[model samples]
Target: MSYPLRRRLWAAALILGFFVLWEVLCLALQVSDLILPRPSQILATLFSRMDVLWPHILQTLWTTMIGFALGVIVGVVIGALIGTSRIAYDTAYPLLIGFSSIPKVAVVPVLVLWFGAGPLPAVLTALAMCFFPIVVNIATGLASTEPELEDVLKSLGASKMDLLLNVGLPRTMPFFFASLKIAATFAFVGTVLAETVASNKGIGNVMMSASSNFDVPLVFAGLFILAFLGVALYVVFSLIETRFVGWANRKSDFAST
Candidate 1:
């Protein structure tokens, strides 16, 4: 088998082993389903209630995507500013750092108070959760551009915009994509946090409702759904990264082999 196939097989085996162990432990210890439902039970709940759960899943997915998209746009703009202009970096970086330092959960209430619940607060929370990483990565990528290369481009009469479009942004592709993977997960967290606190829709709200009724299996199922969505988005971005920046990973792939 090829190396990639072998790696995939190993991953599948590990996941299967984990579920098998979990099932065995639950059975052997007579663990109460209320505390930690067996994987089998969770799967059953997921499939059985999927009809009811579908709409909430869509809500959460939509909210997360909107937030993540907005985060990317804002992050790129701010990062470009910080990376390209020393004055912006000096003026804005500290404030950005302070904002990112605030717990996203804490901000969710303020958002809900201002926006009054529903998808808007969730979307904004996800946006807040994801903004910092992309900003940092983009700024780092732009800042890392070689000075010698910049001088050569300038000597060739390249305008600042030309240098940014042709060289700076291209050099930032790898970092930007890396940040996307991280930001995707954060976006989901932010959405869920807001949903649980203020909204009546989405997986987070579903989980909250389930927990209130002591439906542990359904709660776990919601968690599984979130995990699945997060992984799906991560894989999508990974494929896009490979398509765009496979060249960047060539060295690392070779070294790993």
Candidate 2:
């Protein structure tokens, strides 16, 4: 009856409908399990291998968290610097674009070379993958500040730093949190890529190992775990955005609706 209950029911129905469709298609086509296992099969594999998967899941979670933390720190500082100054923005924006264009997966090997194949490479890769979006979003937010507002602040005897600290920083919060949602997903991609490339543990390694043995269900299970982790992290950041940036959120949602 309530809107919230209806939304939850609708989401649940969609997910259930998807799994049912998948199962029906697999059965109707007589699909090979190797190519695509059924959802039930995947769930069975996941539960059977719970002991094996738990450690790798924890490994991935901590690596991603560390990398995400590092990314947030670097991204916020660099983003603020570039956003507040026209000179800095002009000089750095192009360079940032160029840097972001490079595939982070390509850097995993180099990280492995330096760090000698462990969690370090995964952490660094995740940090690298996540920082770019945060930088761009924060910078864009700051750069988009109303010129008239800045002029008014200047007329009121506000120094550049004072204007930036008081006005620019608040404007940047919504963008920063929004970017974190995207960057959190990227952090997962980077960590898993690094793990598959050169790590002894993590879900990526488990998937890779399963692939070698032709254990398709296990591979899918690892993928499922990774997807769960990413979604969970995204939800956490979304909650944070709702709490800390509710004013901007309310305005945006109102406009959209």
Candidate 3:
């Protein structure tokens, strides 16, 4: 009845409609389960494999959370340091850019070598995938503080630390939260990639094994589970952003509505 509820229904309907259309097309075209399994097949595979899937899902969730946690802490600290000082920013930004430029998949082998092919490598890979965006966003948000505001605060005898604590951190909150959504998705990618390359457990391994066995429907089900987690995490962060930093976005929400 209400607008928000109506919007949710519309979104759910659209997703359902897409799945229905996909199912119909797959059925009508006689698509093989090996090539592009119907949604129905994927769902059946998921339900059938729950006994095997649960442990893999748990392993994935545990590794991803650990990595994401580490990434957030390190990224926030480095970002704060860089964002608050031009010297720090100049020194670190290029290095961060260079490091982030490297494809994370390439680093899985090196991580596996060091960590010996278990959750550690997956955690580290997830950490590597996630931290960069957070660092960049936080640094940009902090550095973007208005010069006029900085001058005013300075004229009033506010020290750099004081200004940063009072203004810069709060201003960067939105950027930090925004980056979390992106980081969450990246965390899963890193974890899965690592697991596929080296790990014995997790959804990545399940998917990889399924592929080798030509269980395409099972592979798709594994992918769906990962995607579901990513979407769930993104939603959680979005809700958090709206909850804690909603004040910062009050005007924007009003305008959009």
Using TM-score as the measure, which candidate wins? Answer: 1
TM-score of decoy 1: 0.96
> Tell me, what's the RMSD of every candidate?
2.5, 2.8, 2.5
Best by lDDT: 1
Ranking by lDDT: 1, 3, 2
lDDT of 1 by residue, 185-216 (tens): 99999999999999999999999999999999
Error of 1 at 167 (Å): 0.6
Error of 1 at 217 (Å): 0.3
Pairs of residues clashing in candidate 3:
none
Query: What TM-score against the true fold does each predicted structure earn?
Result: 0.96, 0.93, 0.93
On TM-score, who's better, 1 or 3?
1
lDDT of 2 at 211: 97
| Per-residue lDDT of model 2, residues 1-257, tens digit only | 99989999999999999999998999999999999999889999999999989999999999999999999999988898898777998998899889889999899999999988999999999999999989989898999889899899999999988977898888988999999999999999999999999999999999999999999999999988987899999999999998888888566565544
* Backbone N/Cα/C clashes per model: 0, 0, 0
In model 3, which regions exceed 4 Å deviation? 1-6, 251-257
